[model samples]
Target: MARSIKNPKKAKRKNKGSKKGDGSSSSNSVPSLPVKVWQPGVDKIEEGEELQCDPSAYNSLHAFHIGWPCLSFDVVRDSLGLIRTDFPHTVYCVAGTQAEKASWNSIGIFKISNISGKRRDLVPPKATDNESDMDSDSSDSDEDGEVQNGGSAAPVFQLRKVLHEGCVNRIRAMPQNPHISASWADTGHVQVWDFSSHLNALAESETEVSRGASTVSNQTPLVKFSGHKDEGYAIDWSPLVSGRLVSGDCKNSIHLWEPTSGTTWIIDTNPFLGHAASVEDLQWSPTEVDVFASCSVDGNIAVWDIRLGKAPAASIKAHNADVNVLSWNGLASCMLASGSDDGTFSIRDLRLLKDGDSVVAHFEYHKHPITSIEWSPHEASTLAVSSSDNQLTVWDLSLERDEEEEAEFKAKTREQVNAPSDLPPQLLFVHQGQKDLKELHWHSQIPGMLMSTAADGFNILMPSNIETALPSNDA
Candidate 1:
């Protein structure tokens, strides 16, 4: 029987769910189970269908659950120097209830622990027999993993609910300090949290609660910033900057927060504002602390240097479509990549932001809209792009392109005209095993390893071309 929970929409629908997965490695050098191109930890991808139980087929129904469905979450594995192993491990994500009766403000810290021990025998079968062969042949360094509905064992997750006063749009884990993190929500609030203590407290208790019945944190957020209004969609913590944060909202407002005297935190009285529409995402340069980049529905991207005061240090019209997301290259301070709603992504040099033509490379691979992009922290030239079509592709930007191609790349980035006739053959691997992927991130320590979460569930994975996915010995 399912354990009972506190106040929520109570409904008894004869529904079905699957067992959790224990994300682990196989003992045999080449496991026998069939594998797909992508490996997912737990998939909660909801496939909607209008049902007709009775004759009145006009009533469209939706899946109902008392549990707080996952809205968003962050990986705890980003702690610097984290070692990758098949040993038991744990991870966490920030979550919020999608239920109508619940406060849009209720945010939860969700945990999945003991991600070890695979039940190979009980694991569900694969979509095809060749799947196992594909798994055995792929390089371990590159994940290019896969998932099945009834097979993989999932980590047990525990959760704690907290009050945010509005809907949460994003949660970011602090890379410098494993215990510190922050969230941006509809309440126009940026809340900072220190989770070390909470994690320590649950070390002894097997606190794996059901998907949504998360345990409430006894402590409150360490700090909160309430400078913006309306719903906020972007919030990013600087990897190199200690206690530095940047958050954006639907109000077209962006606030930079810093640690203040005593025990408090403060947001600049004036927000950095320039975008004509809602800011979709923001990222801090991995190599520069004060420098960061922001994308917006205004079809532009702007770079800011906090030291330069409130104005954008440089800005450029980046796309014909809304620039939904942008990320800085981990190895190059001035290198940036942006994804748009029109199913395209571009790579550019921030040094040429003032120039109308700044895109160094443009990729039109996904037929569906783009979601997010990340450069490999280990390989300065590698890029990963996720899309709405349930696919992930890792490209090796360092691949040897012909002199003519190189010349054309520079020409396009310089002149901002004549789109490239073809994508340089830097393409490495393509992953098509998951549906509705929401986000993707690389392992902190592992060079090519990656993790992604979808509406179906979350996945711990990477691509298969480990050799090309990283900086080669010859590169």
Candidate 2:
């Protein structure tokens, strides 16, 4: 179902216009230099040295704001094909805003469309160069340049918001039905909202804006639960079952919800109590309907089987500090990833669980606390992580550098980049510029696409180097 889309052959660096004895021109001559490696809290730029992002490093990149900052958001699985690779993409998502005032908070359902950008093939460098020159000469050539050079264009979004009573701590959309979403509020309550009206309005508004302007819903939630002793950041809907859910709270409690009807759920009051401290996050097993996992502030990860009892079936001391997030690999059922407050993350093979030796790999790259982590739906070995250090990193566990390949790469890039020898070989891409990155998720339908949210705004980008294992339209 998946295929590599990139040309393994690297692009040739053209230096026809370079002048001899010019140090300034030497750096600009190397356009195909690898992405500048940045290590937060360790490296600082000296005077006259500046950090600049190479535009060619990304296939597509866009940044936008939605009036208020959102701490949590979920990508809504759409009717679009599960493996969509077309350009000018459209994405649907739901985000719960953390507004300045409690009453100012709202749940925003958005449809972002017309996301156009460059592909890896370069569209012929000569034509692209000419188009860039024309764009620089005249400001009116912006639209024309986009059409002629296949350049990026500003994406547009249509949003329908529902007024809420409190600031939302976390939100998740049902995978089976994207219109039904649940939000955990600071008011110590979890509420589910049906957003069919907003989605319908957005679908209709794409053609005519006036038709969908007044469809915003301010109605009460279809159901609400206040059984938890405190608010939490953990909530996830089961991918295998239609309406099944598991939520954890700061009070060291976990609850399960079973769908009784389309709009109603029966939450079990007898909570699963394995974690001695706050439950930081929860993730359902992709293959097992009766199984799930939870990470806690007490630095323990527990595996639960609802059929067994209220106690966890197995528990492991997963980290030295609070485990902040977890991502269960859907493609590879046995792999589980966890992030911690100590800025380290680890991958554990569930099948290797024996006497607390399940951790197969661990990394301590980020200086600040790890905030979010997610496995790519399209690639089993690939995952993305965001941290409080204002970075979003993509990693591929299947990558390992042999001595021959490392020497070859060093020979090619030695003049352009001075990368540290200790850098992890599995690190594929590192994205900076965002402030206080809170969360990130890969677009399951769109190959290689990733979206991240931060204190400032949101970023949607696709890295140019990583080969997406998918049947790309550009091919």
Candidate 3:
């Protein structure tokens, strides 16, 4: 029942007539690129005739919850629950959640699948205990080559503490440290969980510290850098250097720390002075490790190159309102996307700058603030964005030119305002709930598949294509 306006001719006419000098009006006539549309065919059934389901649909339906606030997420190579490269199917996620009023949590891990294709059949892999069992059995053997194990081997692993009630605001994983690292708002601490260890002892130790414990000797934090005067809103580990991490706080300060060496570095050298309000999100570039990006409550996106000390590599006065989230496409580091409180999404090209980085493409698609944005790992041009307007938008940037060129093209197209519409039609709208959407994530292994979560506790998995077969009506 929902329809998008298709007014290419009008848009072109509007653009062509606009003054060439005004940058704002230049982007108004840019047309969206063409996308594949799934049409209902004769094979589609009308009533209860029992249609054969596509095997690919089953494979695309597997959705897993990675974390809570999930303010941010990422995927890595050869991760747990992920298949090998030869399989060509794996997805990793990093998400933030809160645990009651106690602490913030972040979870990062990888997922794998045996099948392939956009619509392939997916069967949950059977449980196997080949290597894990072998290691357990071998641990029980003494150094003398004699089996000293008797009663259940004393259960070598134990759960230290259970985090029952909290949510994670955002999470990130360092390629430098395969272990997961996340920032929690409730406890005001950056927690790192090691996957190799059976038990997470550091989290337990922090729990004790909050309870007035004097000594934290038994538990060790790889490094605890302290400069946040208040709750830290966002944190990211450096992909280029091991143990180097950066965090933004409520006080509007970004601090860089070395967790292993206990050394702290401050890069506040720019007159930019960072954000005017609290910082909400930050991300490091996938292609160049030294370059990073940050978004704040003041509706601005700034790219910082640590080598330059405090000033941003480029700053763009992006949104009209608060900028909530930002992400860099893994395939094209030059391209980045951001979501804002203005119910709009903006895509920028890092290379397009006569003065500073400028907006290349923009979409005013939502009725409320955009909550999250994520780039597909497989395709740099494809992006998934979620908004408080209760909808998720999947954008194809590959078909569109960067903003500068788009602006020039639109200026020329406006001359044909009275012509027929040439703009592409809307592909699809995920219209399950009327409630605001909180998060959206794409399957790492499968292209054109994504998962969305809402404040109402509803999580839905949607495929790019949905087809149903019907009985032949010709008879």
Q: What is the TM-score of each candidate against the true structure?
A: 0.69, 0.85, 0.58
lDDT of 3 by residue, 165-200 (tens): 234455555665555454444345555544434122
Report lDDT (CA) for all predictions. Answer: 0.59, 0.76, 0.47
Best model number under TM-score = 2
Superposed by TM-score, candidate 3 places the C-alpha of residue 69 at a distance from the truth, in angstroms, of: 7.4
User: Which of the two candidates, 2 or 3, achieves a greater TM-score against the reference?
Assistant: 2
Better of 2 and 3 by lDDT: 2
The digit string of per-residue lDDT tens for model 2 on 1-475 reads 0001112221111111100100111122345753344444456755544444444455666666565777889999898688877678899999877776777778888888887765553222344877877644432212111211244455667787898778788899999999999999878899999999888877777742321242445779998999999988888999999999998988999999999999999999889999999988999999999999999999999999999999999999999999999999999999999999989999999998974599988988887789999998988999999988777888889888676966665465353444556768887777765666788999989989889877766778777655444567663
Using TM-score as the yardstick, the better of models 1 and 3 is 1
Evaluated at residue 432, the lDDT of candidate 1 is: 43
In terms of lDDT, the poorest run of 10 residues in model 2 is: 14-23
What is the C-alpha lDDT profile of model 1 across 161-238, one tens digit per residue? 666555456778776665676876555677787777665555556755664555454457788766677667688888
The list of candidate 1 runs beyond 4 A from truth reads 1-71, 77-97, 104-164, 202-208, 261-263, 354-356, 400-424, 467-475
Candidate 3 RMSD computed on C-alpha atoms after optimal superposition onto the true structure: 17.6
Model 2: lDDT to the true structure: 0.76
